[model samples]
Target chain A: MRKKPALWGLHASPPGLLKYVLAALPFLVVVLVYLIASDLRHDVNHADKLLPGFGQMLDSLKDLALVPDQRTGKILLLADTLASLKRLLIGVVLASVFGLFLGVNMGLLPGFRALQLSFVTFFSMIPPLAILPILFISFGVGELAKIVLIFIGVFPVIARDIYLASTQVPREQVVKALTLGATQLGVIYRVVLPQILPRLLDTVRLALGPAWLFLIASEAIAATNGLGYRIFLVRRYLAMDIILPYVLWITFIGFSMDWLLRRYMRWRYPWYERGGN
Target chain B: MTDTLASKYQLVIQDVHKSYGEKKVLEDIDLTVRSGEFCTVVGPSGCGKSTLLRLILGQEDVSSGFIYIDGKPVGLPSTDRGIVYQRYSLFPHLSVLDNVILGQTLRIAPWSARSKRKAFVDEAMVYLERMRLAEHSHKLPSELSGGMQQRVAIAQALIAKPKILMMDEPFGALDPETREEMQIFILELWDASRFTVFFVTHDLEEALFLGSRIFVLSQFYTDQRGNGQQIRRGAKIVADHHLPKTPLSAETKRAPHFLDLMESIRRDGFNPAHLQHVDDFNLRHPDSFRTLSPGEGDSQSDRMPQLWDKSQ
Candidate 1:
């Protein structure tokens, strides 16, 4: 028999510390590369807007986060984040309510399924961005249009995912519930609804990416105050400092939402099997 | 006919037939169960025993004929009947206590349920204690062993105080030792509670050991439908036997007569080659009866004399 090398083959298992180091390696490499590139660019052009130095980026962050705007007396970063979060929150909440309603009903009731399945599937297929123009025209390019765009972009997908999850709950469970004296509505709301809630959180977490995409796209095209609006407004001057920080902030917020939802699901539904549906 | 009345019997099925389009599943089915009989049904795979159980549970409707429970036609599934499947009987997201209480909770309005929660919990705990799962009441179904999960499932079903309890291969997923233990446990519960039970399984030994009355439902039976390719014959209750309602024990399973009975059921129900003529079925139970259709009688056996003689 041949001697097996450690940490290099199919038979090899890396220790815990090594595994953590390996996971962080890629992130470290990316930062190192970016820092070197920024330094090199700054040496060639001190006034470079393409890749601002760390000090310059920090100064830009401090201004946007701490200093009030001269015209509006509001911190630019805080104001933009608040505006974007409001639209995102309202849009996502509305989408979740509608999605859960449609999905649970469609999954449980044959008649509701027959009436809605094909139509929702068709609507899901239509590119949400392609209808942005129509939405802007119909609802006007105000907060309503932007929120509607986000809602339209994510609801169908969430509903479809939730429907799939709800259907995966064994027919045995439903029959058992019925035999346990649950009425039709009782089975749907009490039995099916609770079982699918963790799945709902999961679907919402997945929807956040597209929700952010639609929100940013809508704000960039029309909004006067938002993270997306500021990023686009600063783009012409090639203000990489502000753009980079705003982009990182958005990523952080998205990550936190996903993490929070996952934690809540685990805490609330300790019985839920992740990735098992 | 009076003997088969729902008022006399706990459950009665008359000339029941079930099919999905042209694919027949159950045909000319007639059954009458007493209020406290532990009736076990054994059959080959796809013999429609589970389908029959489902029909009685009111989860699915029969294609033709009728089912009566206590003289009222069986409607959609309700608290009057309780079922425990081979698996997924307990709600996965609920703790054992909560699952047991679910039936009581669901029976009342939400507002009333909250006020009556303590009473439901107290009632559920009694059943859980009987199942010896009181210590694990707060644990989720996923946390329990297969046998323990099934015990919880039984507690969950029994808490509702259903008129009849339906178990569809409830012990099929357990290991042999656990299965035997569960068999004894259920027998104890049945003896104590005296709830009418309709248990289904493909395991012949299990059928013989668990049932006070055993029914063999098999598709491998001859009828006037003949052996033509176009003729589709569904499963029928080919045999019914009444076993002595003696005290249940594990040692009884190893007795010679028990093994012999198991062997005969295997031949009668599970063997596709050993087809029995519908007229010659061993319906020896006092409660057993059959309502044969015009085409299902022995007179039509003349058309397929060879098969009929071979079956005899």
Candidate 2:
């Protein structure tokens, strides 16, 4: 049967140029709502830190970013960004390596799967925030504690997701590799590893949200510098101006990281996408 | 070596039986194939033809007897055997050439080592040329047609130079024209290389066209195992016929003797009531034999064992 694209319906193919504006519609509406709320709140009180106006927000960001903090002798925004980024990078790198190793082994070997699957499943259930006091008391409110918290929070989920992806690799492919002269280890690293790399990146992207959550929680409870620490420190004065910009900056960084990772997956593995994974 | 019977056979399955708990999937499978023989097996769906292929491939255990390849007992699947499924056997992350060269690379130096990689690439290129896939070598398997992909799979398997190439419906996913073209393509490659093959397909006609010897596996046959009751058994070789290895031509399909043999095989294996006695089964190949030992529960009606010679 011959079928053509329809103008509008479930099978409709919209004009390409209209797609861009349509995607931006909801985002534009959210900004407008916040702007109106900020203006109305400012009108009621001449000085309102709860929902600062656009000008006040901009000035607060400039002060935090360009000028040095009087107490800390550091550009608060730059220093916070660096400190937060360092922890995030180390934590995520460690989690990815550990998760990939654990998950792949669990998938390929029956004994390893039986040994570790339950333990990993149970480990992922422990809430990072619930153990915050224990971590603080043990690691003593240092960078180690914050980094470890993020690691514990993100690693298990990454491992579990990677395990699932590894298992989902078609059994036929493994058999085919064996038939083609691959040993057991050869199948894992040579045949299976390349197939799972993209899925690992996708899992990391999904795990980023919780990584940030754990980072912020740890910093809020105990830290000298970080975006999360700065946000909490300003909360005593209700400096919404500083808090809002910091929150926005954090979101922008997370979004960019996710996007870059996704693009990397696509670029490195063109055939994987074609495999319709 | 010449004194032993098993040495004459390229693959020997002796008293091979398989079952899952109470359900029997294959039983009394004793078939031996000679070296360089293109043996095609056709059977009705669910007759466990694929299971038999897996047993020979060492992907699954037979549950009873031993399978010897090149006079060596087979175990878990290894580089000694090569297989091509209907699809998805090729690594998607690798290019067509990479897929074909995987055997050589994994057998050679570490993946990072490239000192003699050029030799492996050159060997792969020759197989690619034979399969008419040389130009598409650098492209991904996803970029090729179904027939092209199967060709690449064949080249991939053939490059390794395994003892036997086992293909399970290798061209089943292709269109009619592509399927015929691939059948002929494989025949040409086999005629040149003389690699032993164990091809499984449900299409009876394709079996006649491609095989130097055709094996019909079916569950429709009856035997003397039951005491006036039906014995629940699985597929076995109901018939085996030797075909001449003529170079590819469409006219052989239209020949009267070929048509008659095809029809008889269809009747012998496809019809439930036409089951011949176990001894009288039409195993016409010179290499064919029934190594029935001990209480297989035989009766007086079983055919007498003989050294089969068409002249006799």
Candidate 3:
């Protein structure tokens, strides 16, 4: 009897090169379809607004990135990116700090949990986009409003996720820490907090999508400069070239942030991914 | 009299009863452990062995009773009672060295911990070497094998110099070979340190091998409460034997006397069908005692003649 080959069943795993090819296959197909669609649209109309050709997009990218704005004398893409990233960075950092504090305390302490759990649950349930007008009205249409919008949009979810993660930490660990002479606060801050930080980063990575959504929405509503503002600004003239690249740029930034967070989690907390405790 | 007795014993658990809402877990548990004694508890699964350990550790409050450690009632789990659980004994976030030194670091302020880091590391390294885990000090707990992790946990607990070290099936997760190895290692550690140890396991052989005094806790005994559906009797110490602290050897497990004792304990504690009368429990240990509540053992007098006749 001959031994069976291993490649096409439950026991089969794809080889390394095949695995890479499998991963890239769908992405390549999507790009191919988009190119074909762009060509067909351009053939019908020389200046197609819906699906701009690659050359048209490339020219717009150069203009937005390299050329200075006529009125402000600043490069629009760079300025917008900086503004958007500043808001995003401030909002996410604040959310992470406050979320970690609230979430860990709520999970570790009964009094904190009883006080904040229901309130956070209710707060997280409110659709952030629905409260956009309220945020603008309360904080005004400045940078504060945009940052607040993103903060409100992301923090509660992060807090709740971190709360769940914190609670998932074994009760045995808490008892062990206490037995080790850790004070109540020491157990929370030193023992429980370090263990949950990787989970917090994971929560932040998940919350980044909603953070970007809120950033774009708020910037579209009212902003002089931002990635979202530029996209909306170009949309008025039906400049699909600028809009598409700006959207792609936002995606790239979000993807990179998520990737960086995952990498940092693995690097800093080597035990976390390995399911240490 | 009680004051002197309490002072004499390293740990005194008296008339301890634990219940959760409608379910009773432990009843009338009275155990007095001396300093440097290895008291091992064995029982059937869900026989409330771990519950009794937790109550002594002050991780949970007994429904009614007092657990005094060093003549004082235990309030919350503290450095006085260091525990090594079967799993999750060491913090995964910390390296082996950090885990061992955690007890000292936690007792001190952050700045002091930094300034005294070298002294702490040196002390922890001593324990690491003792546990034969010196080379793995820098590695995280996850990187080590099961037995090694447990060794690290033991080192972590020992560094605290707890009044009574509690281990709840610390070797339960290891393979048989590793478990045997750990048993020998712990016995040596206990012999050298002479710390009061309260070890709980479901393994009868382990209890017999490691304990100076072995307690068989079970819900498998008869009482005035009877076998009615409503009679919710919790586990009690049905048998407590004072075993001689023989020289540590795996070969001793094959001894005829050891096998006989193990067999009798299995029948007494693990056999639900062979429920010994409460009045006739084989509590042979000098420190072993039980408090009988009203009507707990009252009817056992009338049942004794019937039991004797049935056996004859």
Candidate 4:
């Protein structure tokens, strides 16, 4: 008879150098395949076709270093991209902190979620573009409007996700904790918070994509420097070379951000076995 | 009839009644558990066995009765009464060790004799080791099986060293093999710990095995005219809830003794009128109590101290 696997040691395989070698094989294969295929693809050049082969694509990735002269525009674009990244990063941090507080409060408290959900949905429904005019009118077309826009874009999704996560924590656990001499706050921190955190980690990562999308849009309109503004500038002069490269750069950054998120999720929450849920 | 207090007596529950919105669940339940007695309550589903447990723990309100633990009214849940639930009520986020130690942390009396948090933790580890869950201290509840999770739940409840432990079908969800193993494990643990336990189960055989005394709760019967009735048609305290006489702990379902008791109970279960007839028949022919069959006679009484002193 086959014995059931010991539940405690489900993930406790002994570490070995060979294990890492074995695990890396699939990823290494994928990388090699991508590199070979990218090299094989060639493109004919036109004067208007500023974006050339994958070599130019690789060069543009390297060209993040800010240079003077004709490259100054590109360098300024890189700086703007970095600034946008910084703002998005800050917005995520702030929203997560604030959202957790509100989400938990709303989750635990009976009437609070109903009241907050209506208001959050109302605000979230107002498209980021629609709010831009009001934000510009109020805070001017500067960093302040951009920050508020990012906050608006990111906070609702987080608060809602947290609300769902915190509320979704099993009722039995909460009741058991309370009955076992845990104070209300003790129940939240000790029992409720731990269960909610992993899903919320996924939530925040998911929210980052939209946050970047809205931030880029905000920068495209009013900002003089940033990657979005630079992209718009290159578009006006039909500088497809610069425009296309920055687009590729944005895609790569987004892809890397998402990949890192996936890796972190896998490392921290291996028990989330149900894929594509 | 408050005679001599048993040597290791811990709690005395006297007439605890619980009702919700005029729906009385437990009506006048009275029992006193000695320090090490494994008293189990068994009945059909929704027979207020759970309500009796909640009343003892003081987690729910008693509509018209009271419970005393060590001769004091139980106002609310306390660490002195540890409860192990059937469901996996473990905090999923914390590791097994942390879950076990949660009860001992924060809000313990500052002036108490037992100081130092690490000592309490070490003591908790000993209980975990008893359940064979010591090595999984760092693993989260999600990484455990149903049986392992229940063991951790038991370890956590026992960690506080409560005087009276209450368990609600702790082995209800496990498979038959695991269930029997858990039953034996709990029995041994109770023997070692010497804490009085109040266990609730729907299985009568389980009740007979584990309980030093068994309290049968009346079924939920609703009367007409919009009132709820607890049909206590043939309800009374079966004082000696211990195993039957004859050194025959191996209970066969086909045995005359077991079959008579099961048949008698089954007849009462389906027909309330038939239950009253059985009682009347017993009363009319007290000397010839052979209706229950000769084999079932004195089976329960045999486990008692002696036949002469049994009534007293």
Candidate 5:
């Protein structure tokens, strides 16, 4: 037989130090590209507003995060972080609660499913951003509207995910639970609920990206404080330094949220299969 | 006498019939499972054995007639009856210990369970020890072997002390060697516990080896309804035999009589061409009876002229 090329012949997941390096390669490339661009841009104009030097970004970060804002005596980064986190928390938590309730109940009880499946599906399909104006008008441009926007963006997705998860808890488990002396309510809350909780955490982790998107969009549109509002606010001055740091901060925050959820699920439900390595 | 009462055929199905729209599934199944009896049902594929099990489990309602458990009509699945499926025999999410304790935990409130946690675990441990799953109690179903998982499933079901335990091809997923080992293990468990089992399988040897009474369900039986209406044939118990109860081993499967019974069952119910008339079905169990109503259930019995003589 002819010798096949190594790469074309077979492949398996990279192991050991190679895996770590492979993971870091993209980040390394991104930083290298940006460094060269920043160096070139700064060489052209000493006070360039576009693509500020790395030192300038560090200075901006130190100023916003470490130093108190001259106007309000609050650290700008901390203030923005706190505000955005509060809105995200309120929105995501409420959405999760509502979604779990509706989704599981709908899945378990056919009558409830018949009543809500069509409505929930239709609601889920509606572009949440399209109704921002209506929400702002009705709930006001304050915390309510922002939180509602996040809730609207995320609940349907989580609901659908949770519905699918709960419904797929398997007929064998249901019958087994019943035969084990579980009442209808006991089967739902005890048997089915425990089985789907890990799935709930997983769905919530996936919703984080969209949750951030909705939070930022809402904040950018109308908020006086928050990472999105601050980023947009600094844009007029072409403050790429502040924008870049803030963008990185947001990415880091989203990454942390996902990691923390995964960790929690693993810790609490050791039997949960993360599926991906 | 407790012997007479215990052997009273506690589970009775009278003239049961089931259908899905125009397609009938189980027709005129008059089954009587004696109390403290291990009844194994064998059938051809697509012969409605699973449908019959579902009806008995009360997961699905019977289309006609009634099912009685200890003279009381059966409702939806309850702790009175338990099931072990071939594939999903155990909850994958729960630990072996939790799976067994779950039977007791369901009845007690969470507060009470908290107070009685030690007691529950202790009780569950007894069954685990019997199942040889004691050392693996804290592990999930995925961590165990297929036979071990099934043992845990049986322990979980038996923990509840159900009156009847239904196993739907519980050993179907095992390799042949493992299956034989499991058969012996189950027989041991049966000897110890004596919980009435309604075991269903497509394997005739499995039926003969595992059961005190074996019922053969098939769609190959002749029906009075002519071929004009495109009538979909439903599964019926064509032959019910009472086997000798003994302290048996899987090795008994190799005996001549065992193979002979297996062969006869295969020819009787598994063959497509060897269609036996409903009246001539070889139902020979002592407790077995023809409970079918007139016309529907070979009502005329021996009075009718022989359609096809069995004594060739």
Candidate 6:
């Protein structure tokens, strides 16, 4: 029950810190493999075979050997991973903004709740990938369509959960607000929405998973960029090293977003942790 | 003629009648709650005590009659009146301060309002301090205990500086000790503000402890035509006579007259009218009249309409 400390410009507890370190384990292993391969390839500098660097690196690691292969390729893979991470981080930031706006509005307003729940539920029920073709057809091979798909996939679920949580707030409280002479907007913003924001964050944490999945799916189909497309491109040549870095990058981004969101939830809504009775 | 100098009265209900379809709940009910008086309306469950309160607060409409606040007929809820329900009707999302300030935000002056956030916050803090809910200012409604939450609800209502306060069984759910404490706290609060209170309760002791004048609603009866109607709805003063005009002693708790007044309301006005059938009257001996509570007298007088001859 100890509180998590705010550290390193990230709101994370010891466990969250541990989780980040653990997530980096796979990349560390990749780096170790690259280092060993370079050490072996360096020993065979005059070799005429393409596989010498990899094969020698594999054999040298078995024999405790040192060699240098082309180091530039590994650096390129790291750069690609960083670029994908940046894109996803940007994507998540945009999604969070859109989700919070849509969710808070739908959750806090009765008329909006009634108007939106049906359509939002309808869209959410359809497997996000099922609509990929429609997205590809309409906004083919564009990042706009992928971002829009992510926005649609994330916003509705978050909005619906937040709307229900806010609306389901006890009738007595709403009456209490009204009786106190609160204007309609005051009741919603001051009285109603604050109570719902925590629950909305919870929904966002859940929706982000599907949001990432959809973003990856859409990128794999249409986008010429992003980890999803990059990973798919590497698969044709069985370039596991290239694909592995992208996989590690995507996982890192997802985990970081989840952690960041949860951390923010804990800070902004401490009552949420106590279950608020 | 008995007009209060500062405020004539908190509420004046003139010939109020409430009907749901063919069923009549309150008929020709006239009541005037004077400022600074704590008025309790006691009745059996479902006798429209809550409906009466709702009508006074302008939450529900009266089929016929005028509900006036300080001589002004009110058609909608206004900040001048505050209400507490038996159940804790607190907004669970907002902190105690936010809930208290929710209503006042609308009335705050625009110039100082935007800039002087501290003033508004300080005002809310003052009310929270008064309610002893200062520590819970940042806690959500559900995080507090039931009693604390109820206090917050009361605070939320009072923060608007309402002229009249209405309560429907506000302490009906508390244990005896908590209930007594709440009653005393409310009385103290009322003494400070001296706002008129329209309190409803089924507990007779609660009625006597809090109410300056207790009005008991008789049980409703259905006519042969299957119409559910209030019994003697016009007769709010059936036992207003039992209420003593002189100041009561601090030891009024042990006084016989106080007990007698309560017994009368219960035996005659409440139990017989609400529970016992009219045909069962012959089971009692003639000498039972001496032992009967004052409430029984009203019923007895009503039953023997022929024997109870009147000039009218």
Top candidate on DockQ is 3
Model 4 chain B poorest ten-residue lDDT run: B285-294
| lDDT of all predictions | 0.89, 0.85, 0.90, 0.66, 0.86, 0.65
In angstroms, how far off is B282's CA in candidate 5?
0.6
For candidate 3, the lDDT comes to: 0.90
| DockQ of each candidate relative to the true complex | 0.77, 0.70, 0.81, 0.20, 0.56, 0.30
Stretches of candidate 2 off by over 4 Å are A1-9, A274-277, B1-3, B226-230, B293-312
Between candidates 1 and 5, the lDDT winner: 1
Winning candidate number (lDDT): 3
Residue A167's lDDT within candidate 1 is: 83
**TM-score, chain A, per candidate?**
0.96, 0.93, 0.95, 0.74, 0.94, 0.66
Model 3 reaches what TM-score against the true structure? 0.95
Assign candidate 2 its CAPRI class.
medium
Q: Which model is ahead, 3 or 5, in terms of DockQ?
A: 3
TM agreement with the true structure for every prediction: 0.95, 0.94, 0.95, 0.73, 0.93, 0.70
Sliding window of 10 residues with minimal summed lDDT for model 3 chain A? A2-11
On the 0 to 100 scale, the lDDT of residue B168 in model 4 is 90
Interface RMSD of 2: 1.3
**Candidate 5 local lDDT, residue B262:** 85
In model 1, the Cα lDDT at residue A248 comes to: 94
lDDT of 4 by residue, A1-277 (tens): 6554333366545347657876898989976875554445432323323434456555644555445337455566557778878777887788888778778778887788777878987776878778788999999988888888888888888887788777766655665665566777767765677566667777887898788787888888888777787788767867655776788678888888888877887788665532211
- B245: Cα error in model 2, Å: 2.1
B156-207 in candidate 1: lDDT tens per residue? 8888888899999999999999999999999999988799999999988888
Q: What is the interface RMSD of each candidate, in Å?
A: 1.3, 1.3, 0.8, 3.4, 2.7, 2.8
Give lDDT tens digits, candidate 6, residues B1-312.
214311555677665678888776875565566677778888777678788888887777988766778877775666777888877477554577766776676555435556766777898898889888898798887677767777887887877777778887889888887887787788778777777788889888778767777877654322222323444432222333223433433355557877877776686456634433322322131111111222233355445544432211
The root-mean-square deviation over C-alpha atoms between each candidate and the true structure, in angstroms, is 3.5, 4.2, 4.2, 10.3, 4.4, 10.1
Question: Candidate 1, residues A6-74: lDDT per residue as tens digits?
Answer: 579788878789889989999999889999999998899878889887799999999999999999999
Considering only N, C-alpha and C atoms within 3 Å, which residue pairs clash in candidate 3?
none
TM-score of chain A, model 1?
Answer: 0.96
lDDT, candidate 5, A1-277, per-residue tens = 6654433337444556777887899999999998888889889888887888788899989999999999999999999999999999999999999999898998899999999999999999999999999999999999999999999999999999989888777788899999999989998888888777888889999998999999999999999999999999999998999999999999999999999998899888887785410
> Cα RMSD (Å) between model 1 and the true structure?
3.5
Tell me the tens digit of each residue's lDDT in model 3 across B1-312: 458768889898888889999899998888889999999999999999999999998888998877888889898888899999999898988999999999999989877899999999999999999999999999998889999999999999989989899999999999999999999999999998799999999999999999999999999988776777688889999999999887789999999999999999999999989989888999867887666665567664554444342111
